[model samples]
Target: MNTATIDTSPIRILRRPEVEKRIGLGRSTIYLHMQQGTFPKPIRLGSGGAAAVGWLEHEIDAWLHEQVSKSRVSSTRA
Candidate 1:
């Protein structure tokens, strides 16, 4: 008998364009949020001095959910 295993981990690297499209935010906004410590920091791809970077898909999803939750809480308080 043979068994197949499924990778259940949510690990996925998303580049800048995809991340911006998914989150509906532009490059500057993303970086601004990062500087404010409110967004996920991207991982540097390849060697040093390269401008390539990527963010984990799961982290972005989590950030999206957090934004929704914050809005809901604020609305309820009003």
Candidate 2:
């Protein structure tokens, strides 16, 4: 293990509340989109076989930006 060569950037994990607030989607809607393969999926946390899960902040941010861009493009076309 080369400690000096390791990149130490932290990844922000957004829990349900934060994710919902950021994406404007409720728990059920988020889960539904996930199942439909239309949204980013959450990552499992910890190692105790727990059911805890969260979405990466950056991923959610990208999704929101993409959605806005698509909306603008379609509205312009119409």
Candidate 3:
């Protein structure tokens, strides 16, 4: 019998467009946040490619949680 193993990594890389769609932000907005160091840094997918890609899904999820918490806190204060 033969068996195969599957690899599972916490990081889920996404293309620029897909990431923008997922975050509901436009291309410029995405770049703006990146410039502010508030967004995940993209990883180079190739040595000489013009396209940019990135991962750290866990980080994004954490960011979402933080936003939710902030919203709740503000509502409670108001």
Per lDDT, the best of the predicted structures is 1
What TM-score should be assigned to candidate 2? 0.82
Kindly list the per-residue Cα lDDT of model 2 for residues 1-78, writing each as its tens digit.
Answer: 656776568889999999998878899999899899989999988667777988888899999999999999999999
**Model 1 agreement with the true structure over 1-27: per-residue lDDT tens digits:** 658888887678999999999999999
Q: Would you estimate the TM-scores of all the predictions?
A: 0.84, 0.82, 0.67
Candidates in order have lDDT scores of: 0.95, 0.90, 0.74
Candidate 3 residue-wise lDDT, 1-78, digit = tens: 657876675557777777767678888887888899887777887766675567566666676687689899999999
In model 3, the Cα lDDT at residue 48 comes to: 66
On the 0 to 100 scale, the lDDT of residue 15 in model 3 is 76
List the lowest-lDDT window of 10 residues for candidate 3: 51-60
Which portions of model 1 miss their true places by more than 4 Å? 1-10
Q: For residue 59, what is the lDDT in candidate 3?
A: 67
Ranking of all candidate structures by their TM-score, best first: 1, 2, 3
Clashing pairs in 2: none
Model 2 residue 9 lDDT? 81
